[model samples]
Structures are given as C-alpha cells and as structure tokens.
Target: SKTVSTILVTGGSSGIGKCIAIECYRQGAFITLVARNEEKLLQAKKEVEKCAINDKQVVLCISVDVSSDYSQVESVIKQAQEKLGPVDMLVNCAGTSMSGKFEEVEVDRFKKLMEVNYLGSVYPTRAVITTMKERRMGRIMFVSSQAGQIGLFGYTAYSPSKFALRGLAESLQMEIKPYNIYVTVAYPPDTDTPGLAEENKTKPLETRLISETSGVCQPEQVAKIVVRDAIVTMGLFRTIALFYLGSFDSIVRRCMIQREQSKAADKRE
Candidate 1:
C-alpha cells in the first residue's frame, strides 16, 4: 500500500473538498484544510477531526484565497508542514464555477473563474512539487469536473478553466513520473454541493435542462473514487485517460438520448 501519512486539501471547507478531507482522515492521514473562509475552515477542521483514527493525528485549517497570491499559499503550506510534517499527498480541490453564454458573461467573470479554477490548482501544486520531487515520493490529485472534459451549454467561461487542468495534469504527470510523483485528475459529474447551488442561480435554463439529464452525484461518492484512484499504483497517464474516457462516454450517451427524444417529439408533431 502507498504510504499517505500527511495530506493537504484545498477548498476543504465544503463540498467535494471537505468530503475528500474527511475520507483521507478516515484513512489515518493527518489533514490540512485550505479555503478562503476562516469560519468554514474551522468548521471543516472539526468535521475532519472526527474521522481521525487517533488523537495524535493533527487536523489543521488555513484560511487563504488560493487564487490570490502564490506567496501566501506557499507560506501557509510551509506552516502546515512544520506542524503536520511533510505532505505526502496534495489534493487540488479548490475551485469556482460560473454559468452564462460567452457573449452575455462578463469578461471579468471569465478571468475570475480561470484564476480560481485553474491557477488555484496550479499555485498549490507548484508549492508542493519541489519538495515532493526531492523526497521522490508523493501523490497529487486535481478535482476536475465532467464539464472539464466537454464543453457544455452556458459553461463557456467555466469549461475552459477546467479543461486547462487536464492539460496540466498530463504534462505534470510525465515530468514528475521519474521522481516517483503521481498525478490523478478526477472528472466528477454534477455534484450536490453548496457551490452547485450558487452556480444554479446563474445557470442558463438550457444548461439546467441538459445538466439534469445526467442527474447529480454525492460529494462523498466522488471523494471516495478520488482517494482510491490517487493511491493506486496504476500509471498516472492510464488513470487519467480512463477517467476522461468514462466521463466522455457518459456525456455522449446522455446527448444521444436527448437527440432521440427530440426526434420522437418531432415525429409526433
């Protein structure tokens, strides 16, 4: 079994990130939760601690905007290492989403989504990669969405940011492989989370109708899959490729069904 003694999770205050933290804690890894919300970070720390196998297992929280400053993120990561020891696993779960047609969406919204969803993952990975390489042992997982795999209605601003993660994961995996570092990218379907609720407010009606066809998945379920995949000894490239294929298959199947339904309606007319 891969040794995952110390774990750091960004966006750990809620949603899939929080669930991943809890799952990792359950596996006996010391957890560090990072998010922009101090209150939520503290709350998440309390929840993660409950899953700790022993009192000695430290559950820490850092309140920092992952998209804001790399220096601040690096500082917090250093502090976390000092208290909890080296991070054996880093999960890049910090991200944001928005929904609108490209023309209607504000340009700033596109930049903001990219900053949080793409660079948010990049900054933390940059912070940890050097140490992980020097130690020649580590695992990194990026929490990408099914939206990342394929463009979707009203997600023009959100999809590209996530798509960028896939490119990062692939290139980073190859570069880090010789150093014994592993990278895994997760493509979870629309998950039931507070973030999803917020996105729903801005989601276009067409987007809502299309997304609903695939239904919603639980954060816990996605977290479980992510953790499991992260620890697997399978080649990083193979793992990531399979994840994309599976998500792509789901998308294609859903679209075909929608098309068939449209044709049936046309026939009736």
Candidate 2:
C-alpha cells in the first residue's frame, strides 16, 4: 500500500542491493542505484527498466563509493534528490567480508568493514533523514545479516559492523518515530550471492564448514520479503527474521567467535 516514487539503494550493482532495486521498480518506485562500479550499475539499470511496471518511474544509476567519506554519500543523496525528487526510500546494502581470526586480520580490514558496513548505513541515513523529517514521511532499511543478529565464525571484520548496524537502527527507530518515518533493519540468512560465493572460496575451511551448518537463502527471495516488509509493514516486521537468528547462541559464542575477545559476550551467549 505504501508508495515509493523515488528510492535510493546503496551497493545496488550486485547481491541484495541489485535485487532490491529490481523489486522496487516492479513495485513502481523510480530507483537510483549507487555503487562504485559503473559498468555493473548500468547493467543493473537495464535489467530494472525491463521489469518496471511504470516506465514513467525512472531508473537512474550513479557511481559512488559508499565506504569512503560522508561527504561523498551526502553529495550523491543531494544529486538524487535534485534529479529524482525527494528520496521516499533508502536501502543501505553495501558491505564486504573479511575472513580470519580477529588477531590475524589486519586493522585495515576491520576499518574497511566499519566504514562500509556501519558508516555506510550511517552516512546515507544522515544525508536523507533531514528531508524525510521535514516532509514527515520516508522508509529506511538496512540489509544486515543473520550473523549480525547472532555471530559467525571467522567473521572478525564482518560481524562487528553488522552488530553495530542493529544498534544504530534500534536507536534511530525511536528517534524517527515522531517524524512518521520508518526504519527497518533486516537480518537475512546466508544469501546466495556472488559475494558470498567468493567468500566461501577464499575464506578458511572452518568458515566454509560453519556456513554449511546454517541455511543459505537466495538473494532474490530475501529481497522480496524485505521489500514487502519494509514498504507494507514499515518497521513493524523488522525483527521477525532476526529473532530466529538469536536461537544459535552456541554457534555465536563457541565455534564462530573467540570467547576471550567477545564484546557482547554475555548478551549473545
């Protein structure tokens, strides 16, 4: 029932972001996909236009590195607003995995995850929230992971960033409630995406073993449910997928993470 005439999806060239962009077009939302890869963005734009229900709902692609600075993200948001009108929806989906023990992983790897995963979500939300607040309507969704809800082994650089996202969304939900803006944070199961496939190969054997123990869902499937929940129910159904993730405490604590190094050890364990 909710209508998003103009939407922005970060990391829209691949994985869940690309699928979300396509689904938004199917639902009649004009989309601007932001990512660093111009070639992929162009290809994704074509695919979205092909599935678009309303040709009038324009699909635009802008190349921007979400992991960089806030200023870059803000500029992209400003451009999207001027070109496509105010952003009715914002989806934060750009992220990467760094596999290794926390001590073995480089500091830069952790920093990269924080910038792209946590700050990637933060910068865009900051850029658009003012307008959404002024207009008194908007939808903000974060494509967090099941690992974020629980924890995954060898997710040294990845899990903290996603966990940070949950904290960010929880705080923002209360702050934005008065403005009639909705914030939905999703924790999807391991998704079958190119990125995940690559990680499965390069990551240590332990990482692959742990991933098999849990189920993996298709990106398109997760995207469909995410879009349906974000648009139709707003923030009401945010924790549904994440709730099941909480059941794996042992996996979160013993196999996946170092017991001595855990941050939210008591809460998750």
Candidate 3:
C-alpha cells in the first residue's frame, strides 16, 4: 500500500484528476480537491469521500483558478496545509486545450492555452515545493498528454503547451532529487474527459486522425497508471509509448501526402 498521507490535486473536480483522488482515497490518504468551480468541487469531494477506506481520511475542497494569480494560489495552498498537514504529493492536473490549424486558431487562444496548461501547473507546484523541500519528502506529478511527447499535424497551439510540462518535470526533478522529492511527468493517452470533448468541437481533421491512432483511453485507467508511476520513481518514456509515437508519425505522413495530392488535382483543374 502507498504510504503518503495527504495529496493536493489541481483540476480535481472532474475527469482524471477526480479519479486520481478517488484512487488515493481508497488507499487511505487525505485529499485536497482544488478547482475553479465550487459546484464541481463539492460534487467531486462527495465522490472521493465515498472511496475512503478509513473514516479518519478527510476530503477538502477549494475553488480557485490555479493559473490566474500566484498569490491567490499560494494563499489557498497555505490554508490547505494548515488544515490537512503539509502536502505529501502535488498533482498539477488543471489544463485546457484548443485544437485547430495554426492559421485558423485565434492568436489569443495560444496565450490562453499557455496560461492554463503551463503557468497553471507552475503556480501550484511553486506554492507547495518550498514546504516539500523543507520536509525532505514529497512527490509531484505533472499530467501531460500524449501530444506532449509527439507533435501532430493540427496541434500547433496545444502540443507546445503540454510539452512545456516535460521541461518543468525534468528540471525540477534534478534540483529536488537530493531532497528526496520525486517529480514525474505523465504523457497520458488521449482520455475521455470533459476537456477533450470541448477541444473536439474545434479540433482539426488532421489532428483528430493522428489522435485516433492511439485510440482514446478512460480517465480512470489513466489515473491508475499515472498514480502508480508517480509513486514508483521518476522514469523515461516506456517502450510501448514509443511504439505509439511511431504509429502517430505514420498518420501525420499520410495526411501530408493527401494534402499534396489534393493540391495537385486542384491545380490541374
């Protein structure tokens, strides 16, 4: 059984974040569910509470945008610690995605995605890290996406935001290793989540095609894998993950060929 006692998860109101909270609760850990929606946070707290193995475990909910203001994030984290004890693990799971061809996507969305996906994670991690280092024990998980590891045809805006997490995870691990705080970056397969549903409305055909190569995964499955990995150690890309990347490359190449042939036919007309 996992030994960590308290965990704080940004974006814990739904999807993979909620599922991760549930899994940890089942293992008898106190949980802090953070999100921007008070309603959703309450709903998630109820769900996570149902999974507790011991009556002593507590579930706390806080509504705040992790990406908005650093001071606000820091304040909320301090409150959480005062109530539940220092964070044993921090999960940076709050992120947003907008998918379209580079030209078709509004320039402003690029900044929004970066603010939500990159800086959103940075704020929470920064708030908790000082305490983690002082305690000499902690685990941090960055919930990156498969797109984080591989650039696809229509993910010009989204991929880069996700990719930034890898840099954060790797570099943070190097500095924190001596303190016994492990940092893990997870490239979870495209999962069935509310965030993904919103992105699909604007997702481009080429990006959808490449994403389909790996098929969509369930958020619960992703949470299980990621939570397990986060506890074990910092790791590199697994062999199976590399194989999926190879498959995605073929899809991108096929889309490129189709676009060229379509252009040739139009010119002939």
User: lDDT (CA) for every model shown?
Assistant: 0.88, 0.83, 0.87
Give the runs in model 2 whose Cα sits over 4 Å from its true position: 1-4, 236-269
- Model 1, 200-229: lDDT tens digits are 998899999999988899999999988999
Candidate 2: C-alpha RMSD after superposition: 11.6
TM for every model, in the order presented, reads 0.86, 0.84, 0.86
**Which residue pairs clash in candidate 2?**
153-256
Order by TM-score, highest first: 1, 3, 2
Summarize candidate 2's per-residue lDDT along 20-89 as a digit string, tens digits: 9988888888899998989999998888889977547788888887878889889878988998899989
Superposition TM-score, candidate 3 onto the true structure: 0.86
Task: Give the clash total for candidate 1.
Answer: 0
Q: Write the per-residue lDDT of candidate 3 for residues 1-269, one digit (tens) a residue.
A: 33558999999999999999998888888999999999999999999988878778899999999988999999999999999999999999998877888898899989998999999999999999999988989999998888899988888898999999998876676566656788888898779999889889978888888889899999999989999988875544342365764466466557756977999999999
Residue pairs clashing, model 1 = none
TM-score of 1: 0.86
